[model samples]
Target: MHGPASSGWLLVALCAMTGTYCLTRMRGGGATEQRRAAGGEALMGFGMAAMAVPAAVFTPPSWAWSVYAALFTAAALPALWAARAGAHHLHHLVGAAAMVYMSVVMAGSPARAHGGGGSGVPLLTGALLLYFAGYVLLTGVRLVPVAAVAGRNGGGGSAGWGDRPELTRACRLSMGIAMVAMLLTL
Candidate 1:
């Protein structure tokens, strides 16, 4: 198994895929389908949260951290707003909170690292990764039930061609990416 600190990029890749899938579904132009696509936003939130774990663990340059911080914040605001519109899917709320928590963790990392006596980078990163793994695992598992619900309702109907496999595959991809990234850190 891959170590925890390296998993950030996997999270980024997963977020990217999840975001892409969501955007594609949103473009389908069916209100119901579009509403369903909002789930992607939650995935993105989880992915981004996963990403922060590595970034914090790896301690990339200050600039990269800043960029990630800004992008994550921008991405999460809409997710929170979207959650407000669809309160039934608690995933939205959890995902949004995860993303926001990631942002805080990312912002606080530098200070934490600096405060450490010396050479605590690895420990810091490991903690971040652990948090991310937990977040991803929980969020990722949470999505399965939602997707199943969608599949049972109408997601597996005619729209199945466009939605089911793509969403399901995207979830797997996200987990895989996070796993790979974490391994790389070792």
Candidate 2:
């Protein structure tokens, strides 16, 4: 990340925490799809944390960038398969692709080489920014208390911490915001 070390650390903390929470969610009893979704989110959170690490703290070897790109590209395949069952999986696919895109852009950038501003195609960056901004807004709206009241009133009673929809939405929203922040650095 091309920014103050403090901000980069903050992003790292947020993403790592989110990833840890998602790992717990995966272990909790839930539908297969839900567990699968949580698993994917966990992967994304950890990957983002790694990518968000301040270049000044640890500049990865040149080969590491290609590895990152390859990893996300491979991750996208499962997301693509899952997308056939649910629209949420489509979001996962996009997120994986975005990570791959960032890895590739960062690999060739002189700014990253010097621990300065990141370089990327302006148009693609703008498009990704717009998509993530919209996702953050939509996820934020979904997290409003009014939306939770109905679920609370349902006969299911209190959901387990890991299975709580609100928290899942909040987690997604946080990642969306993080994505926007990451893109801005680019």
Q: Model 1 residue 16 lDDT?
A: 68
| lDDT per model vs. reference | 0.49, 0.84
Among all windows of 10 consecutive residues in model 1, the one with the lowest summed lDDT is 112-121
Count clashing residue pairs in model 1.
7
Pairs that clash in candidate 1: 2-183, 6-181, 6-182, 7-181, 7-182, 10-177, 57-125
**TM-score versus the correct structure, for each prediction:** 0.46, 0.90
Please report how far candidate 1 places residue 139 from its true position, in Å.
8.6
Which parts of model 2 are misplaced by more than 4 Å? 113-115, 146-159
